[model samples]
Every structure is written in structure tokens, then in C-alpha cells.
Target: VKQIGNTHNREMLPSCWDLTEAVIRHLLNMTDKEFFYWGEYLNEKAKQRQTQYKGPHQVFQENV
Candidate 1:
């Protein structure tokens, strides 16, 4: 929108990460449980792939 100076509500598009981020933020504000749920999901994903990288340093970083 800034590219053309348009001031509309910025139509939500799938490719726009900002839109998804905004929705998650709105939900987080209304319910705190989803906040921890998302963190756990990401943590599980990172943990599952941590060993695939094959580096002690990478594994250590993911543990954090």
C-alpha cells in the first residue's frame, strides 16, 4: 500500500506474512493459551530438525 500511497484496510492476502502475524497477535491478546501453544509447536519443529543439521553448535543453539 505504501508503494502507491493507498490508505485502504490492506486486503488480507495469503502471501502476506504480516496478515497472519497480525491475526496471531489479535488472538494472543484475547486468549493467552494460544500464545504458549504456538511456542510449543515451533519448539517441537525446531527440536525435530535440530539433529538433521549435524553440528554440536547448532544442536546447542536449538536447546535454548
Candidate 2:
């Protein structure tokens, strides 16, 4: 569990297994709405990256 600046070093994962497991676990733990909601969150985050956000930003909702 490597943490720097409140972020975990995802690159430290030996392979994609941990990531896949985490996604599967998240899907299994969340409801259908939650799954789609999470997907929207990811989409918004991606957009934020494209927009060149330059501060401590949080993606809390889906982009419209």
C-alpha cells in the first residue's frame, strides 16, 4: 500500500490482476445504478484530464 500525496501508486501493481479484481469486487459490491454511476464518474474524470485541470480537483458527478 504505497501512498504519496493521498494517492496510491497503482503502478506498483504486479499486473492487471489487482486492478481487475478491484473492478470485479466493486461491481459485485455495488448495485446496477451504482455501477453506471461509477462509470459516469470515470467519464467525468477523463474529461477533467482533457480539460487540463491544474489544481487539487475532485470528480463528484457526471459531465452533462
Candidate 3:
């Protein structure tokens, strides 16, 4: 998780790590096929968002 944050050049909050760890623990209980499909789904979503992604600050300003 730390490596992922570092790779993205983002500073992850402790709560983010906790949430990720919780999700990982839940994923671990899934069957191998289920886990593989989940990984593919997440990767696809990430790719789809890669081009027009907005940071948190931008989102907040737009909302405000």
C-alpha cells in the first residue's frame, strides 16, 4: 500500500491504509477466480479514469 502511494506520488492517510487493509482482508476470503475478476474490473476502471481524472481539491472547488 505504501509502495502504491509512493508510485502515485501521493501521501496516503492512515485511514486510507486502514481501509485498504480491510478491503484486502475481505478479498482474501474470495475464491481465486473471483479475486482475478475483481482485479481486472478495478484495472479497467483505473484505465478509464486515467485520462480525465480530477484531484480532490478540484472536486471540492467545483462542488463549492
Best by lDDT: 3
Full ranking by lDDT: 3, 1, 2
Backbone clash pairs in model 3 (N, Cα, C under 3 Å; residues 3+ apart or in different chains), count: 0
At residue 12, give the lDDT of candidate 3: 46
Tell me the TM-score of model 3: 0.44
* lDDT, model 2: 0.72
Query: How much is the lDDT of residue 24 in candidate 3?
Result: 86
Q: Per-residue lDDT for 1-64 in model 3, tens only? A: 3454354444444568788999989988999999899989998887667546777865675679
Off by over 4 Å in 2: 1-19, 53-64
Error of 3 at 16 (Å): 6.9
Question: Residue 14, candidate 2: how far off, in angstroms?
Answer: 9.1
Q: TM-score: which is higher, 2 or 3? A: 2
**Clash tally, candidates in order:** 0, 0, 0
TM per prediction: 0.45, 0.46, 0.44
Clashing pairs in 2: none
Write down the TM-score for model 1.
0.45
True-vs-predicted CA distance for residue 58, candidate 1, Å: 3.5
